[model samples]
Target: MKLYSGIDLHSTNSYLAIIDGKGKRIFHEKLPNDITTIVQRLELFAGTLQGVGQHRGCDREKA
Candidate 1:
């Protein structure tokens, strides 16, 4: 199982997406507009999805 993280830091509200090796979405969530929160979420999700070979970003939006 492979996991990837994508964080869209928008002005109003940021969005996060987690994708698997075969391009399947596991988690798509809306988070606060902050870097710390995003990192924390990513780390937590990363820990949950261990043994993943690689992480990738499909599309990204600058905060």
Candidate 2:
């Protein structure tokens, strides 16, 4: 099944959640509060996660 990803960024760290079309949580993690780290973590789940969408400072959470 296809998958969807969402991220929530904050001051200290960012929250990430991945869910499948079937409504199952595939993977979740709180990365190093940086965009690069977020991308790297997602890459590990690239095969299962796609169509990423983020907000709340997530777009600017970069090195």
Candidate 3:
């Protein structure tokens, strides 16, 4: 049941997607560009998250 997550981030909005080791999607949504909101979504998979990935030009230094 290993889980993974990916985010396609944008300036104003983003897409958050979660999937299992088998590549089956468990959760996906378009959400606002707020850190708290993003964290909340991710919290759903708290202890099970194996890895996470993000795409786009957002600066990782500030994250």
Cα error of candidate 3 at position 45, Å: 0.6
Residue 10's lDDT within candidate 1 is: 59
Could you estimate the TM-score for every candidate?
Answer: 0.63, 0.73, 0.86
Structural RMSD, model 3 = 5.4
Q: Which is better, 1 or 2, measured by TM-score? A: 2
User: lDDT score of model 2?
Assistant: 0.81
Candidate with top lDDT is 3
User: Residue 1 error for model 3, in Å?
Assistant: 1.2
**Model 1 Cα lDDT, one tens digit per residue, 1-63:** 667766666565777888887889888889877768777778877555644332333567789
Cα lDDT of all candidates, in order? 0.69, 0.81, 0.93
| TM-score, structure 2 vs. true | 0.73
Writing each residue's lDDT as its tens digit, candidate 2 over 1-63 gives: 678998887888888988989878888888878778888878877676658888785356568
Worst 10 residues of 3 by lDDT: 54-63
Look at candidate 3 and tell me the lDDT of residue 39: 95
Native-referenced Cα lDDT, model 3: 0.93
Residue 36: error of model 3 in Å?
0.2
